[model samples]
Target: MTYTIRQAVAADLPLLADIERAAGALFADANIGEVDVDDVAELRLIESVARAGGVFVAVKDDAPVGFILAAPLDIHIHIYELSVHPAHGRQGLGRRLVDAVCDDASARGFKAVTLSTFRDVPWNAPFYASCGFRILDPAEWTPAFYLAHYHEADMGLPLERRCFMRKELK
Candidate 1:
């Protein structure tokens, strides 16, 4: 199936939560960490991101099957979330959504794209690496990265299995 990537509109916001839940369910099967089905982007947050022009969706038959959420950080685009329904998984939709964010950031003259993900999850760090992101060494971490780790820790994520990565746009 061919999926098209585009900026998300207000009407598309509600569907994104469903996509997030479905996508996150995949983690439950991974048997790692707590998988909270309700841990999804709230409508308010999605609306805010949409308004900021930072949300993009992968649409199939005019419905969102996947989406990527990002925003400008101090010097790069920070991808807060990326999700593709498990039913639609392994189709490169995730990669395409990631590429869209990277392309958008590059066009806006951002230095790079950054994100945090599970280091041991094949679809997390390894997938991002395949997309040209490199795991940032501890010495390469910035203040923002430290804060990100703090936030992740506060959320009960396994920090030891988490790592920050960056994909330079230039």
Candidate 2:
């Protein structure tokens, strides 16, 4: 199936939330952490991201099947989230979204793209590694990373299983 990758729009926010819910459901089968089916980007947040040109979506047959939310942080493009409906999983949607973001970031002078994911999840850190991302050592973390870690800890996420990754765009 062919999918089109484009900047997300205000009207696409609701569909993005649906896609996120479907994607998050996959983690429930993983049996790790609390899988909140409602754990999704809020409409206003998605609107703001769309307005800032920081959100991208994958559309299949005119329906959104995935989305990637990103922001500029620590002089790099930080992917806040990337979720695709499970029905569309393993079809390279994630990589396509990441590549589009990375290309945009590189053209905008960002040195790298960074994100955090489960350390052992086959489709998390390992999948990112296959896409040219490498695990970032704790000693090499930026100040923003420090704060992000603190926030994640406070949220009661599995910090021990979290792995920060970076893909240098140069």
RMSD of each: 1.0, 1.1
Clash pairs, candidate 1, are: none
Q: Locate the minimum summed-lDDT window of 10 residues in model 2.
A: 44-53
Q: Write the per-residue lDDT of candidate 2 for residues 48-142, one digit (tens) a residue.
A: 76665789988998888998998887888899899999999889999999998998889888899999888888889998999999999999899
- Stretches off by above 4 angstroms in model 1 are none
lDDT of each: 0.90, 0.88
Judged by whole-model lDDT over C-alpha atoms, candidate 1 comes out at 0.90
Tens-place lDDT digits, model 1, residues 18-85: 89998888898776768898889889988887777789999999999999999977688999999999
